[model samples]
Target: MPEGITAECLMENIMEKISDNLPKQKNASFFEDDKSNSMSTQFNRLFGRQKPVHHLLGGGKSADVLLWRDKKISASCLTGATVVWVLFEWLNYNFLTLLSLAIAIGMVAQFAWKTASGMLNRSPSEVPHLVLPEHVFINIGKLVGVEVNRGLNFLQDVACGGNVKQLLGVVLSLWAVAIIGSWCNLLTVVYIGFVAAHTLPVLYERYENEVDGFVSNALDQFQHNYRKLDARVLSRIPTGKFRGKKFE
Candidate 1:
């Protein structure tokens, strides 16, 4: 509108103004603050309002202080021994009878201790606590709920064209697990898993570099084989435009 200002000059001025207002670089601190707040909020939503309980009986530090110690090794050993015992007893063992015997022994021991304490006029020892606190169960429930929600969200994402290949691979892996699980008893699977959980982590930690190298080599070999297979077979298949796009 001014006498010396042409349309080009006006456009240039507007572009410069826009460029001046644009951020030159991302603020790392701002993003870090946001991420911390988000994680804190999620943590609070899961466990903040729950009542504190004794740490020895399924509370905070229970896993690290109790289960992660020599007790884990002892439990693993007991599990292995039990499996061996069952195999040896193949047809003659009765789990119910064994359980009843254990209960009877425990009851008798408790009763004897109480009688002795009463005769001596001494205080009776408190019973060993095994029950988990309500808060621990609540936290577990919340974790399961979150995982279920995440799985549903993943399904929705897959349905909406969000990486079909990766999703299909995950589904196939789960299906394979289910097929294998069909041949295994739940308790056996759990016992093996429990033992592995305790043993594998310590092994890996003790041999971190060696484990990393082994894993890296194995992954490389797998990828190489997968690529060769893909080229030999999958490449012949015609994926539509949407199906062929690379997912981030």
Candidate 2:
């Protein structure tokens, strides 16, 4: 009657109780057949078949980690896109040209983010489309994407510079641009479009992929741990008593 009693012990007790009521020979065969059948059913339930669609979509539980990951990525992209856009606007000085450029950046950034978001929302059965539509994203969004991507690239190059001098050179160049003429019309539109095409969603996508990977790894660890404990503890009771005589 303990909360954590083993299934084998519980089944043995049940068999003994049944034997007391039934003829001895009948009880032995009955218990043996019940054990075999219960094992067959358990094996089938554990590994024999695929999941139905209704349960996969609407059931309160799912075994697929990808489902959880897609949701997390979608949410992150939406939040990140909005926050980054707002911050870029606030941090950079605004004039008519700058505002126009910012508008262009956002327009492209949102679309880029949306592509990644769509992939995250896609089902496992569906094919993922990593390529973004150029026709849809206009000049302004392209510009924003370019700036962010260039910034990221500049950092990467600085990090991997062959010597300290080169690294310092890269840093100085960036500082000079920021201090002297980042606000000026650098014909930033062309570069922005090119960079946004590659960079914007890619960063968000990578973040999402990392989050999903982390969650998946964690869940796998939990299920592995639980299976080891559960088999020893909960898998031995009579099917009739715990799972009903017939599985529906």
Q: Could you tally the backbone clashes for each prediction?
A: 0, 5
User: What TM-score goes with each of the models?
Assistant: 0.51, 0.18
State the lDDT of candidate 1 residue by residue for 71-138, as single tens digits: 66556565776675565355455678778888999999999999999899999989987887999999
Residue 99 of model 1: what lDDT? 82
True lDDT of residue 205, candidate 1: 45
Q: What is the lDDT for 199 in model 2?
A: 45
Cα lDDT tens digits, model 2, 125-152, are 3436579777567876888899998887
TM-score of 1: 0.51
Q: Give lDDT for model 1.
A: 0.66
Off by over 4 Å in 2: 1-143, 181-248
lDDT of 2: 0.57
Q: Pick the TM-score winner.
A: 1
